[model samples]
Target chain A: MRSPTEAAAGADDLAAMFGRHARELLRYCTRRVGPQLAEDVVAETFLVAHERRHRFDPSRGELLPWLYGIATRLLRRHVREEVRALKQVPHVPDAGYDDAAAHRVDAQRDVARLSAVLAKLPRRQRDVLMLYAVAELEYAEIAAALEIPLGSVQSSLHRARAKVKAAMSEEDNR
Target chain B: MSRTDPDLIAVRELPPGLAEPSDEAVARVWHKIAARPAPRRSSRRLWVPITAAAAVLALVGAGIFFLRPRTVSQPAFTTDRETVTRVIGDLRDRAVTAEPVSVGPGQVIYQTIHVV
Candidate 1:
């Protein structure tokens, strides 16, 4: 059992950690699972991190990747929901004859198409791709986040990018 | 890292709405985290169930050990004074009427008796 002082200190640490990384973590989760489920994922991520804090080896990598790793694991439980959400990315209707509206429509179509492609990707490849493109983590950070080898990360990302490129080109040719 | 890659551009252009989570959403998450119970001492939590399980197992084992049926080695037939007397009388009668038997080098006699 933790003493009162210890509990208070742990709470303070959690608060500090939340303040430091919650926003970005939330954004990353939102991209993967939409805002509706992202909040829960974020909360659960922190709770898991707090519970497993003792197991975290500081020598391995930065705390952000660890948080991401935790979030990614939690996200696995909601993969079906995520894929459904991605496949259902709403298409914005053409509302006007202006260039801005035209651009918005084109962008929306691209997002919808890309989301469909993402939904169809294999889970590991999608994870690697999202960690690279959405979370914007480097190869080393991605490897740490997924607990995969650096070579696996590179290969998975390469395959993901190739697939995405092929898909986008197919969409263009259509 | 190529800026001209259409795939990268499309991925980067997902939507502005997903760029940041609302402040209220963040607060709700913070509130949930703050409201969660403190992490239980794992050893303390685990010891209780483990001890309980061991005790139940011990009790079950004791019940089986004490309640199970037992086997005893006994004679095939019941023995009584009357039966023993009758057997002895018959053996004496047979000896009186029997012819004398010759003894051999490797031959031996075996006998069984029931005692009460």
Candidate 2:
């Protein structure tokens, strides 16, 4: 059990951690969502981590994976909010294809393609894949961040990897 | 390159030259983090002055309300000065209730019934 003093000290340390890692976390979120939504998601993620810092285990390898987990949760919430907001408007795109203008740059084209494929995956599978493949977190760390059984991580990772690979290949054929 | 292998481990990696948050983005995040008071310490510091000012004002207001006597509402006598002094003494002889209640600034009520 932590003393009140220890908890207070932990909050200060977490503030420092946020300052050092927020940009990297924002960059990571941008690759998942579009750049337009990245900063808001990053800010919300850290604010959440700050409020829940007591749950954070300092024994954990690095704080980045934990922040990624928070960012992933925020991204899902962002997507759901966007969907609800767009439902009011007419002519929703079939696959959430942002206009070509948004994907004009070569790198953004790749990101847009990848994002479209990612949007098709089940939420669980997309999360597992992003944490494992994009954030480069190990299976154990991903499980801890997600608070799920380790075996589930393995299964989700396999399914997500297969789907993304197939999608990429099909895109190449076109 | 095995272009046909869709089931292969696609090695999803960060693309080269992926867009990073600009220097401005980093600065904005840093400024926010820095602007926040180191958690508990900052919250404590922020409340101290506010709490102190509230307490001081409360004490000062209470002292002013209880200390001053109600002179404005006292009756003025048009009779002779001696008779007025005598009447004031007689009014003082009766039990006068001077309990203060809130009404407005610079005004009060004092009720005294002369027992004949």
Number of the top lDDT candidate: 1
Model 2 clashing residue pairs (backbone): none
Best model per TM-score: 1
Task: Encode model 1's per-residue lDDT on A1-174: one tens digit a residue.
Answer: 445444334434888879888998998898888887888899999988888877666656677777898999899999999898887778668656998897778767767777888889899998988888877788898999899999999999899898888878876785
| Residue pairs that clash (backbone atoms under 3 angstroms), model 1 | none
TM-score of candidate 2 on Cα atoms, chains taken together: 0.52
Which ranges of candidate 1 are over 4 A from the true structure?
A1-12, A90-105, B2-5, B41-116
Q: Which 10 successive residues of model 2 chain A have the least lDDT summed?
A: A84-93
Q: What is the lDDT of candidate 2?
A: 0.66
Tell me the native contact fraction for each prediction.
Answer: 0.73, 0.21
Cα deviation at A56, candidate 1, in Å, is: 1.1
How accurate locally, in lDDT, is each candidate? 0.82, 0.66
TM-score of the A chain in candidate 1: the value is 0.83
